[model samples]
Each structure stands twice: as C-alpha cells, then as structure tokens.
Target: MEINPAITFQHDRKVMHAKRPKVLIVGAGLGGLTLGAILQKSDIPYEIFERASQVKPLGSCVALNATVAPLMRQLGIYDEFVAMTKVIPSIQIGNENREVEFAMTAYFEEATERFGAESRVISRPALYDLFLKQVPKERLHMSKKVLTTKQGGNGILIRCSDGTEYEGDILVGADGAHSAIRQNLYAELKSQNKLIPSDDAALPFNTISLVGQTRPLTTEEFPFLKKEECQFVRIVGNDKPFAWSTFTTKQQRICYSVVQFLDEESSKLHDSFRNSEWGPEAAGAMCDEVRHFPVISGGDKITTIGDLIDLTPKEYISKVMLEEKVFQTWYGGRTVLMGDACHKLSPAGGAGAGNALQDAVVLANYINALPLHPVVEEIEAAFEAYKTDRIEWCEKAYATSKMLQSVVDKGIKPMLVRFMMKNMPEFMKRRAAEQMYSSRPQVAFLPLDETPASVKPTHQRSLNLRAPVEEEVEAPAKTI
Candidate 1:
C-alpha cells in the first residue's frame, strides 16, 4: 500500500459535491488525524475541523502498544514514530515511599514478541506534530468549532461556531468525550424516535490529574529514570485512590502524571471545575495538592511530586479529570462517532489512544470498501458495519480500563492480583498478554501478510476493502 504524506486540492465545490463521497471529520485529535491519514492514503477527499488553532495534545505523554504498529508502519512514518518515542520495557510498581511493591519487565518483551511491535511512550505534542506534518494544511481548518450536524437530502450538514455550514456525504465525530457532534447526532436520532440506549452521562470520575514533561532527571539523581525502557509506577495507597507514573520520552526530558481520586467527595468539585479557568492558580493548587507525595526511585534516592513539578515549565502541565464512558448509539444514518465520542476511557490501562487509532483503522476500511460515487444506501451500510464491528468492544474497553484502574488503585483483592502480576511466571505472563491483545482491531486495507516482514506474528486481521462485487455484507439493522 502506498502512503501519501500529503495531498493538496483546490476547492472546487461543484465537482466534489457531485462526484465521490466527502467526509467531514470533527475534532483533530488522534482519531481524527489518523482517519485523515488513512483517507489521504486512499486518495479520498476529506476535511478535518479542529477546535484548537494548533494541534497540541493536552496530556504530557501517550503510550503506544504493538496493536497499532502495523498501521503506523503502513503510514510510512514508523521510522519517524520510532525516533520520536522510547520503548517502555519495564513497569516498576511502587508505593508512595517509592519502595518497590512489584515490577513487570517481562510483559513488555512478551508483548513485543506476541504482537509484533514494542510498546512505546512518547510526548503527546510530538505525536500530534507527526500527524499534523502528514495532513495537508488545506484539509485541516483550525479554530473551526463544530456546533451541530443534521441529515441533508442524501448527505450530512455541519454547522460551525464561526457561522459556517459545510456539507459532506458522511460526518464523523472524533471530537473527544464531551463531543458536540455526538450530542447533536444523538439529538437528531432522538427527534426521529430512533435514538438507541447511549451512555450520555460523564463517566463517574473521581480522578483528577496533572501531567507534564520536564527536563530529564539524570541517572545520578534518579538511577532508573534514564535507563532504557524504564517506566516508574507509583501508587500512594488504597485508602485514597492516587497514582503517579513517570517515564522518559524522546528528547532529554521525562513525563510524569499525578492523579488523585476524589471518591470521598461529590463529583461536584470536578463538575464545577469544567467551567472554571484552568489558570495559574488552579494549576498551582493542583501541583500543591500532590507536591508532598513521595515517589521512590530505588535503594535510597527519593523525590516528592513537588520536585518534578518545580522543574517543569508551568505551561507544559495539563490538569483534567479522567473519564470512562461507553455509548451504545454509535451511528444512525450518515452521522457516526468514533474515539472518545463513543467510548471514553480511564488512563489506567493506557488503552484510550490505541483504541481511538484502531477506530480510525476499522472505520477507514469500511469507508474505503465503498464503490466510487456510492449511493446513500452504500454509505449507510458502511456506517452500520463500522458500528457493529466496534460497539461491543467499546463497552468492553470501558470495563477493561476500570478493571486495570482497580489493580493500579489496589483496593483489597486488587493488591493480591497486583502481587501475582509482579512475580507471575514468564509463560503465564505471556499468556495474559496473548489474551489481552487477542482481538485488537486491524485495518481492513492492510494485508494479513505484512510488507516489511514482521519478525513476530502480527495477530491482527485486515479488512478486505475491495471485496467481490457478487458478495455483499448485509447492512446490520440499528440495534438497541
């Protein structure tokens, strides 16, 4: 498959509207950017509308597993991706005092062996920069906030905050958890009495975190901080659900996140925070909240959360609540949703980004499978297939994320399970990895037999975008 880095097109409204289907994607996060990359590769025309003027991810770091590697390689940016990230081969779990409670070094190797790519950690901004590099400037309209989407005659119409309306054969919501597109899509469906059971409420979140990248901590200051593939995991206690993760990125810098679960109080503080300005005072308060939390390095070297916070430039850190929500109504008509719009996830399992990219892969495959100048029926069927392929996993992903969060939080039984995971047999650990990654979604366009020769089995499926015309996949009816 040929991956085109960018495709520039002059705006010819008549030709585009009369010919092939055009996709209008909301939100330029990972999912939207990934979809744009796929469509560009397929020579499909599309536009990405982002709320932000520039595509800089809010979080400090993003974890990429083997599951999405093939697609990355297919994009022909694997080398760049590799250069921008570091393999996180070791995950050392510890207490507030930094005393080692349990460690898992073998799982990373096993995952690489079983899944065909090494798990990596990268600066979130760098990741977005890579995607932005591939996407043509003409195709991405920054600061164009999408307000609503409605079904047009045979396509979909989108209204933006800037008093603009755009039309496309299909509209996709990659607009994060609190998606305006998702809300409008569901509202349209509800008006027709066709809305399915959806997870509308924000995930019952009690966790608030501040994550940022800072100047690298030297090996002399923190021994394992510079070690290859080292990922430090710190859990304060079960009494209060709090955890800290510190790891290295590409540049001479480290990224850290401190999360505190507000289970004791009403989510009011969190809910109230949504509208408040996240200015200096708020960031400072969040930093002060966990400044004294101990983060252990090893035998003797120890530091508090404040130490790293003090080193980090004030602008790098982001404070936000971790949410986990899964919606049942993924699609109706030509409007469909992907990524955080449909399924939100906790940061525990590091599954959100991977899952969103997977959504791009699967959804692209289905859309690419369409015949040239497809009718409304074909577009609708593609949307149906995409939803059917993803809804179950969407729900399961939310459950799985919380399940891992429990282990990280270590309430009671989770502590024992965490212990077992720490010293588990190599064979058993690999088995767990095998099970965990067994059903990862694959792009329909990628060949089962990879191009650049994979050393390990890619254990992922490919969608046959170009199928026999005689055989047609029945468009699934909308589900409850």
Candidate 2:
C-alpha cells in the first residue's frame, strides 16, 4: 500500500507537532517575559535570553490600562500582580493653588464590565518576578546578548556576543527601542537595496524626570495629594519649570517623580550634575524651589512638608529621563520589533507600557498562526500584518503623550493654558475625555476564527494611511 503525499505530509506534521516549535525570545523585560508565559501556557517550546546575569528589582512603577488586565489574567498571574501592586483610583491634575483641575479614573468597573478586567499599577520588578515564576529556570538564559541574526531557507540563527549561536524556527526581537535583531534585519534589507528609512520626528517636549520614594503622608495631612492616586500638580509662575506626581504603591509607599523641561543651557547643566557632591546641593535647591513656589500654600502642612526634607542628593540619581519620538517603522522582516523598540512615546499619558504590551500580544498571535513549516513569504506576510495593524494606534499614543508633555512643560504659558482649560465648556471636556479614553484596536493571541471583527489586526484594514500595505512589502528579509 502506497502512502499518499498529503497523508504523509499530515503524518510527518503530527510527529513534528509533538515537538513544539522552538521560539527564541530576546530580552527578559515585560513584553518578552509576558510572551514567554503565554507561549508556555499554549505548550509552545520557547527560550528567553536576557543580557543581565540575574534579575534585579530595577525600574519604577507602571500603570496598566484596561486592555493589559485581560492579557495578565489570561497568563494566570493577574491576581499575583494585584497582590504585588496598588489599585490606584484616579489621576488628579492640578496647579500651584492645590486646586484640582481634572481627575480621571482607570474606569475599573466599566472596564471589567466591558472587557472583563481592571487596571492596576505595578512596580516593574514585581511584575517581572511574577512572570519569571511562570517560566522554568532552565529555559531562561542570562548574560546572552544577541549581536546579530541570520535567516535562511531552513531556519533563523541568532549570534550572541558571547560567541554562541542558536537556531530556531522563529526569532522574536523584544529587545526594545534599540533592538539588535531589528537593526541587523534592516541592515540586510538595505544591502539588498530595499531599505526605506522612515521620516524622523522630534519630541514635542524635552523633559527630565526625577523619581524617588518619600515618607508616607495621610490624605488629610496632604490634602493636595491623594493616597493611592496619581496627582499631577503644576506650579505656574515658578522661576524654574516644575511639576510633580504622587504615585501610591501596593506596599503603601508613595513614589514621586518631578518632571521639568530645561532650555538648551539648563539641559546641558542637568546632564553634567555631579552625583557625589552636586546632587545634594541640587536636591536642596530643588526642595527650596518647590517650597517657594506659589502652589505650596494650596495644601495642608504635611503636603508642604515634602518641601522641607533635603533628600540625599544620591536619591536624585534614581530619576529616569528620556527624549522620545514615534519612529516611522516598527518592522523589518523575520526579525520584527515591538514596544519601546519602535516608538518611544513620552510617559505623560501613562500609555507607553500599555502600547508596548499590546504590540507583543499582536505580534505573538500573528506568528503562532503560521504553518509549522513556514515559508519565508509566510513569515514576511505575518510581520507585514503586524506593522500595518499597529501604526495608527502607536501614532495616536505618540501624539497624545506629546500633548500632555506640552501642557506640563509650560513655563510662563501654563497660566494661559489653564485659563482656557478652566473656561472650556463641559461639552468640550467630555469630548476630550472620549478621545482620551477611547479604546483602540488591541492585538490579541486568539485564533483567527475567534478574533472579533473590531479586534482584527490593523494590517487587514484598508483605512491605514500612515503604514499602507504597499509600503510594508518594500523591505525584504535579510541576515544581519
């Protein structure tokens, strides 16, 4: 009896399917680790490589949007996340007078009712730890930095800085904004004379952020600041640019970050600030500046108390600052990029992590749906779909973040903006809220058949103006 070709193919696929496809995930950050956990639950074979030798509780707090809550729940770690983080109620925006201007909550109840999930805030390290728990230690590789990647007819190969090589069916570059795999892939595409560099855009606000922890203050003591709330207090008519936020954590720790936009000279001076000696003086100066600002009088005694402590200068060193932009392209072949790796938006709107997490979900879903023995054409097609699906949402987020930065960066002009904001009609405020909170298309890992029509990948839509279908095919896959 002769075995039919299709039957043989089916039998071979069954045997091969028993051994899950090997997925190599670069970077152990939120996006990468989340993808690893989701793949593990799906019983897909995978390995995660991080440049850090060991996991450290690094980075600051992240605010989750309604979209991410479901993904976290799906990973079986949502409760663990909640246990490790705080559920902030609303974000309050005000000025030096301590008067509340605007406040927006996460819409938790509505989010749960509509999306079956609620948003929460988690320290980066805590979330990472939770994700690490779900992944096996053996499958997690550390101190492995991807230097380059090569794709051939058979499989994709990743070359590391340590002179080691790993071959896999697919390579997911979750390495962030400056992704090595993504760079290498683009280099190859350019070598083939097919690379198209997207237009570069400048950040609307050039801001610096100083983040640190402070002694807890009661709601009554610091009436201007709310416990478990993100309060944005802007001080108008201040000599120097100043804005501060009070972010409460699950541990009842109040984490605060002060942001200011410096002009050319001040920007350089800030960069050259000395940690050993200058930091103390700078912190003291910053405190003095805050105390003298007109807004300090708006709150009770405890609220003004933050203006007294001369927090060690070294504490100022913990601040994370960035000058960001929305890049033109997010993909370049068998090795595509996601998250901050594509567009590094300002953190004003608290949507950076949310957008990045959504990118990972969408990309992972597209790749998992391909045939086990995928052709280069099929891989390219999937990447094209991912890029097309995400551009607009990313752009909108990029724009919104910049606008928020502009409002905060206001030096002498804040008074004018405030006047307009205060005088704006209720109808106008509602319209703005609708735009701000409107749900964009989310990329999920559901089977194509189960994906809702509204949730369909952005690439499939004819409405994409920024990232058209024809433009997506311009760049061909290449080895770095």
Give me the candidate number with maximum lDDT. Answer: 1
Question: What does candidate 2's lDDT look like per residue over 171-195, in tens digits?
Answer: 8877765567667766777787666
Question: What's the lDDT for all of these models?
Answer: 0.73, 0.60
List candidate 2 stretches off by more than 4 Å.
1-21, 96-119, 199-205, 214-237, 265-299, 302-317, 411-480
Candidate 1 residue-wise lDDT, 117-174, digit = tens: 7788888888888888788889999989887676743567787889988878788999
Evaluated against the true structure, the overall lDDT of model 1 is: 0.73
What 10-residue stretch in candidate 1 is worst by lDDT? Answer: 1-10
Q: Looking at model 2, report the run of 10 residues with the lowest lDDT sum.
A: 462-471
The collision pairs in model 2 are 96-295, 176-341, 177-341, 389-458, 389-459
Sum up the clashes in candidate 1.
2
